[model samples]
Target: MLRATSRLPAGPSGSRGHSRPGRRLRRAVVVTAVWSALVVVAAPGSADADPGLRLSNAAHLAPGVRYETFSVTASHGTAHGHLLTVDLDDARMKIELLRPGTSGAVTGIRAPVSRLADARGAVAAVNGDFFDITEVEHPGVRPTGSTVGPAVADGRPLKAAVPDGQRYGPALVPGATDEDVLGIGADGAARLDRLRLRGAVVTPSGTWELAGFNQYALPVDGIGAYTSAWGPASRARASCGTNDVRAAACGTDPYEVTVHHGRVTSASATLGEGVVPRGSVVLVGREAGARALRRLRIGDPVHVRHRLRATGSVPLAFAIGGYPVLRGGVPLDGLDETAAATRTAAGFSGQGRRLYLLALDSGAEHDDGLTLGELARLLRALGADGAVDLDGGGSSTLVTRPPGAAYSTVRNHPSGVPERPVPNGIGVISSA
Candidate 1:
């Protein structure tokens, strides 16, 4: 719900006024009028106040879905771009967070947006989040985000939220950065929120802290398992094996883990194949984490406290970690003043009833991209109540599949040599 804050006048018995019925009524009327005006001013400002960007190539791809290309000329530079707007009017349709390969396979690295969308049968999609793109020898060392941030798809956490004291980038709160977040509820309503994730292994003996989920862990360190809900569903590959026990390798220290349902089922030094079995969880890592699991026996009470929490409940959430360019129709501070490059962004309507996706392609040499402030103004002009930056430059991409189309198509030009594979993506799903 939208709320407005305003200061009310002093009580009826003010120093300058008497506490009479007529005077009190007049004062109340004035106060009410002033409060209402303040709210209106706080609401989304006028569209005419936007930048010089002009919209063209506007077309409706499906009910509640539309795409439009735009361009703008500014003192800093010129920009050419496109945006996909989605109105949550269709009750049967939904939005999802797209990772590489199958929904829960824990192996394969990065793929194109087209492939991720087609593999997931999405109606529309875009590159999502910043990731660790450096190449590594380990198969698990694929290009996953340095911090995938908090993501929940279909009520399951594909990636864990940001832990305490580890927050990076600009945000309104310590955990909730300026990196704008998009959350879709089961009711098909879209909400914008700032959130973080925390996890631990809870057992009858005691609770042990977790660093993260589905990522690399240090030797003699602590790490959790990957359920079928997490795509790329494979166990961390241990370097050595003694009997059936996974032995540590990769120049890192060695650790072992035991996975089971409500108790110890199987222990391994290396990750296992296929999805985590139903009604089961895996414990992998070393040191205190390993010690904690070793103490548990069959039928011992164990639970994985891995879930995403928000100010409100949302079955789905994905992150785009760019500084907030706009808030409540006003431009934010710290937008780059000099450098201008191709950009990507996401935003919400004034009432939070609509969502917007934007990607600015590299145009003429002089027509670079939009400054953060300029981008915010453009979104405000386009009716965005709040907006945040997405991975831009070469990583910025926009893709969509028409309602009857069999596959998704890239709608904008990528600045990367060809097209760079991203760690994860945000996609639209047709529940119909």
Candidate 2:
């Protein structure tokens, strides 16, 4: 799906007597070719060695860079990825996801999505999402490169694609001034808390970097009733009314979610002891009591596992300038990626491998946020070309269970279920 750019400008005939413009252009070509060759011969430019895995103990998972992102996939209640609740900056960092498909098919988001417009900025996605690149700031109330820190660490600088904007310390960019940027030291210690990047990525966030992303396909977890597939005889566990999937709580489907390992249960993130909305869960409940689902929660470590299936029929879209888009207006399908998320139905036509396994780690929601390097590595582990960041912390949930269970509870914040219900949850399910 990668596109080739226009070819080099044509040179004039008669090599030695060309005009001034032609001569300069010829020089440009020579220089460009040499530079390209150097790049080809260079080492496999890993932005940096994997973080803290090199160090004995690390406080957080960040590789010390900043960015914005959009990644969407059908995890369907399987856990091939981690949903740890760490922190970076909430108001400063945001991840959104959607499954834009109808009935049984799926779609990918592709388009020039409008951005909300902020200070310095970054954006990334999987199938794809759209937004404008206003700006991104780090650590302080005001957003500016000066308030930011260098993304480089341990002898690694920004990625090759990073344009020159400002050079604070040892930083460099297209518009980079020698006076801008903060906290980049020759000894590799960051001076500032967080550094902000001002550019934007137009494609799926994790794809270009080709790092890590998770995807999954599983049976639908029904609400209001349990499915026979997840009954007592089945190895799958069940829970309700507690943030801790393994703990017991007092509530009648009290909007609480608990995960169980065999017979014992643990941990809980109960918002309030109240029944969730009717269409907020899908956990293989009995048909008589089943309903659509609304949210998913990736609450903690210890999780449940389920086999997943996918059809590769979903489409993703981004809201650009308040309108839906596809391919950031580049054009793949008739509709744009912004619009495709909303209009897509089942049965999209593409002749590629149509299966994926997504991992989900329910809870690691500490007061902090997740990082790009951590996400990339996770996605790579999931065998994804990329992975999208969705609502997390209390807002992450996974709904899947046996076919004989009675009900599925809500365990996340924000909206309980996605706008619509699907067949499964790609969760990292586990037993107590």
Candidate 3:
């Protein structure tokens, strides 16, 4: 019995039916007070941060499980690094994982709270749900919300139940609720990822490896996962309302691998009109990850990797391609020096396409633990066709765009707190 005292997040003021569970826990209010578990309030205002993060800057995060506000900073404003993870420092918060009696405790100061903890209590404690994920470069603040429940706004509920549908893959966009399995791909091979997606494309567009992928749901999709109407690769090949069954192999998405000796040619993203650098990629087509199946989506988990090279075009820009192309296109600049060794990054490849799936060292967070620089190297070395980083540290979210989870979508994991529902998810839908 760790008797810790921390300020509480006042529940909904005088609302009806304040269930027993909703009475005790904090409701994720933006309370900037000191919340501790084994201690008292330490540094206040650390929890509340401007959503739009300042690049290369440092943000002193919350009072950890104890007396510590972990420091997180960017590197010279340049998105570069290999290791990526959320720092808990010693957070102190009550965990409500299998506690049936604690359901209505914190009736959502902002939104209702969900649990995946290992403790049971009536007090307010603090701790973190740190996760290993990919941190790519985008424009501004990290994307939020992808919880699981009733509608909230741009956020998702931390809990909701899908009717358990068919087969599928990550390729849905939702606010904070509806766990959306964003069907974004990499430029290369075996690229793990951690990110929150926009509700634009069932398989939205971007580049780079989705670094850390630790969130798993029931059976994302039975066979539909591979042939689901709007799966990962389906949208890539499904030109318009038609599944490029020929190009996509099976039919749905979640990329499938038909063995022509257990291997086929990987796809490529040619340079379009732009000042793409010799190694700086500029465009990544839809069918980038369409054909490569052997090493990708089979029955278990798969990692899609990609890169941004300025080597493709004259002015240097980003283009999508695999390892075979990676080794042949750009020279090694990071760790591996041998040209042929660079080919080692290309785990699998053939004619027009190449695939690379190098095993990254998985540690406490099951992550390569890379910084931006390391990430870039991994992308190139691994043969990423195109890749983009997602929200990392603590904000990497994955959600569905809603028709609801009856469709089966899974987002990020170990979320700090669940989110309310929202509208307009940054989705990756296909006209096909």
The best candidate in terms of TM-score: 1
Q: lDDT per residue, candidate 2, 1-432, as tens digits? A: 111122212222111100111111010112112111111112477333222211011111122111111122211111222222211122222222222222111112111111111000112111111111112221111111111111121222221111112111111212222112212133221111122222211111111111000111111121122111111121111111111111122222212233333211222332222222222211221111111111223432222222111112221111100011111111112221111111110100011111121212333332222232233333333222322232232223322222233333222212332322221112111110
Worst 10 residues of 2 by lDDT: 209-218
Per-model C-alpha RMSD:
14.9, 27.3, 25.3
lDDT digits (tens) for residues 152-217 of candidate 1: 656665555332222333223322352236666665556666554456776666666654465432
**Runs in model 3 lying further than 4 Å from the true structure:** 1-368, 377-382, 385-391, 399-404, 407-410, 419-426
* True lDDT of residue 366, candidate 1: 29
- Tens digits of lDDT, candidate 3, 1-432: 000022122221110100122222112122122111110111456422321211122221122111111112212112222111111111231112211122311111112112211122111111111111111221221221111211111121122211112112111222111222111122211221122221111111122222111111111111111111111111121111112111112223333222122222232222112111222211121122222121232223222322221212221111111111122223223322221110111121222122221212122343223343333334333234332222233222232222222231222233444432221121112111
Could you say which candidate leads in lDDT? Answer: 1
**lDDT (C-alpha, whole model) for all candidates:** 0.55, 0.19, 0.20
Cα displacement (angstroms), candidate 1, residue 360, comes to 1.0
Q: Which candidate do you rate higher for TM-score, 2 or 3? A: 2
The model with the greater lDDT, 2 or 3, is: 3
TM-score of each: 0.69, 0.20, 0.19
